[model samples]
Target: MMPQTTEMADKLDVLDRGSDGEQRSQPDVTAQSSKVSPLDVLKTDLPAGLVVFLVALPLCLGIALASGAPLFSGLIAGIVGGLVIPLISRAPLSVSGPAAGLAAIVFTGISALGSFSVFALAVVIAGVMQLVLGVLRAGGIAHYFPSSVIKGMLTAIGVLLILKQLPHAIGLDVEEFGAMSFQVGKENTFSLIARALEVIQPGAAIISVGCVALLVFWDKVPALKKLTWLPGPLVAVLGGTLANELFQRNYQTVALQSEHLVRLPSTDGAGGLLGALHLPDWSAITRADVWTLAVTLAVVASLETLLNLEAVDRIDPWRRKSPPNREMLAQGMGNLTSGLLGGLPITSVVVRSSAGVNAGGRTKAVALFHGLFLMLAVLFMAPLLTRIPLACLAAILLTTGYKLAKPKLFSDMYRLGWSQFTPFMVTVLAIVLTDLLKGVAIGLAVGLAFVLRESMSRVYEVSREGQLVTIRLNKEAFFFSRGKLVSLFEELPRDTHVILDAEAAPFVDHDVADAIRDFQSSAGLRNIQVEVRGLKLAPVAPG
Candidate 1:
């Protein structure tokens, strides 16, 4: 391959094979070496971890609030997810925590369970179920999804990040933080955009625009590219926060309020952190409702985690393949620990992982250090971190989203022909309009339909030699394929000898056999001769 083509091929491989990705995350959610150098951890992963931590902190709090759980629960899950899942998951870049996708589920689960502690018990049991799924090798299901659908899912996530965060960027729209589903309360994604336009904050808009501008040019400039360790997001958030302070001091009217900043429950004093945690109510285990919710949580969390895991691995810079089973195991442990520690249920978050990748993360320490940061934040830095404006963070995500759903990706998909492009776009639209899992299902169905049609076409091949026309059966020709085959048989030249062969077919549907027999019986009327091979239908009598 030529240099440019080779590079493009490598990028597609990264997008398809669970390796080499250039950039945002997906529900706004790779493979790589199982090993890392200590220096790499210190110089690369740690900085990326800080960047991810900055991204994750607000999300943790926001998701918990959206889920109607204690605000502290989101932080707990983030800390546990950051610290635990990385230790066990083979996916080096994935960062785990309270996810926006699960907020509605958690909300309903909590209402059904009657108490947060009871819901915590269900989360623990859900973890056990995930462990069982891992042991059963359920993660193998990851391989079945078509590459087009997967890419669509990733792209759809990018679109979601942009739509969901656009209002946040402008520091308007009335939805709670991390409430990013297509529908939230009374507002849908698009309606929120209209709302944002109606209520813009000048300071918040400035911060978002500045941060986005910085991110766009940060790597393009030679001077900025040299400081890879200094992630653009870290600077954006810190600077935005400082700018917010200056706004308050010098220009009060346009300054962002507390609602536009990171919101964490204070964890100061001697035992405030410990005081905030709520232990699971083990006594609730006997209720069928608890088990029911547990099963639901397990299935949902595992599915989301698996999908996110696949997406991350597909884009890993090192092109390393992560073990899906190990990811399940890690998620199980993470959820289990979170439930015990008074946290909401946990999953690998696409947004945080993608942000880390976009920021140049290279090791598992990205997760570990982020988790550690969460812990430190809870112990110490809540007030300072809270100073950071959501608009700046939104800018970072908007930049990431632009990378994932670039115009080039769509055009490239279109060039792959309908077989690929159809499903890819379907998946993207379904995901953007609906939720992640539903969108994937809709896309998978379309892709499979194409596969089935293609398979039917491959069931038989036709060839002609002089007066003989041979139709050779392949695979197992199904009843649904008989119509096409019979039509082809009818189109054969009237005076030619036609041979029906089934040597390659393992099984022929009865409908297909009858069609062949009917053709043989009538061929003489058209001066056509029929010969049968391998097919066991009795020879037709003279007409």
Candidate 2:
């Protein structure tokens, strides 16, 4: 064979082998082996960790508050996510933590289960379920979701963050921090906003507005963008805290109270840390409710983690693929640890992962360092953290939400046509109306409906010229199309020459092939001459 033809054949052979699920051997010098030294990685990782720490700290507190769990629980989850998960996960840039998406589930589970400790037990059980799922190689299930539905999910999450955070931003302290569901506390998203409008605290509103403006300015201005070392959210938090302190000292009327700021349990030493940790109530293991919550948590957390891993991988500068099963295993271990230590259930979070990527995190060290920072902060700077206003954190999340559901994303989706746009919109609406899992389920149903409709409508193409008729079966002529096929066969004109062609079809189902053969046998009665081609005959039963 010619050299070019030989190369083409080799490439085809590789592709064929890949299709059979065979693992390809790598070169002696793998990508990771040739990477930078640990010292160089540390240089990049430390700064990135600081940025992620600044981003993660408030989210941890906020999500915990939203879940109706102890605020310290979120911190514990963050610590485990950062300190433990990275040690096992293959995704270098992905960051795991207490997820906002699970706040609603945690909140409901706690209420139903009767205690945080009981819910913690559920989380532990959920971790075991995740480990099982990983071992079963179920991580690939995430790939089955349509791209439009996934995008819709991200968009819906963004909208939820903005809507949920608005009350906090405007200084309404009634609702918990990081509530993502439509209904939070006693009020829904809309009612909460309406209530906030009536009872907006001037100091909180001012700080939130200023912080949001600063974040936007920092993001958009080219000169400000050059200062990458200083993350905008960190600046916003520090500046907002100082501004709040100033207001408290001078203008008491506009000053935010302690209730409007973060409240972390102070630790005096190792003894204090140990005392603060609440162990799970292992007695709840036998309860059906506990097992239900465990299954739900495992499914949701696994889905979210896989999706976040995919998103993070896409944005990684090195363009590395994360091992999804390994990620599941790591997350399982982290959640198990968190549950034992009184933390909220953890998952790979998009917000923190994206922040890590944008902050130039080169390795897992960044995540490890961020966890260390969380540990150190809780140990020494708990009082200082309490001074940071919730409004400032709300503002930061508002920006994060905007990035996820930007107007441009909607426009781009619309341009992709109705098939893509319809499911996308449905998912968004469902999520807005209900919750994440329900929304995704609704979207998947709609996407499948579209697929079925397409399949049914395009079963075959028919054309006629005088007495000559051609019926060309589609690439997928399956049993599902039997009804249409039967109708088309019956409608054939008398005394016409009918050609039933399946030569181009990759798969002609047994039922379809049988139908074609029946039509061929019956054509004589209708005075039609039928020529069936390329369909493999099914085996006949022995008389």
**Model 2 misplaced regions, further than 4 Å:** 1-47, 108-115, 282-292, 314-319, 358-362, 514-525, 539-543
Residue-level lDDT tens digits of model 1 in 1-543: 113344444554443322223342220001233444576567677888999888888788878888999988998899999888888887877888998888888999999888999999998999989989988889878788899998998898889989989999998836766666787777799999998998888998999999998887886886875575788778888788889999999999999888888877876653988887788998998999999999999998988888888888766766557788988999999899999988999988788999998887887789999999988988888778878899998998898888778877887789889999999999999988888888989999999999889888899998999998998998898888889988998898879988888988999999999899998888889999988889899656675
lDDT of 2: 0.81
Per-residue lDDT tens digits for candidate 2, residues 1-543, read 113344434544442211012333321121233264666456556767887887788789878988888888999999999999999998878899999789888889999999999999999999988988889988887788887887788778778878888888889877767556676646788998899999989999999999999988887776765454566776788889999999989999999999999777777766788887778998878999999999999999999888777756654555568899988899999999999999999998877876665555677887998999999998888887889898988887788778778777787789889889999999999988787778888998998878777898987899999999999987898788888889988988799999888888999888888888788777889899987788766544454
Worst 10 residues of 2 by lDDT: 15-24
Candidate 1 off by > 4 Å: 1-35, 463-469, 475-498, 505-543
Error of 2 at 476 (Å): 2.2
Task: For each candidate, give its TM-score against the true structure.
Answer: 0.87, 0.85
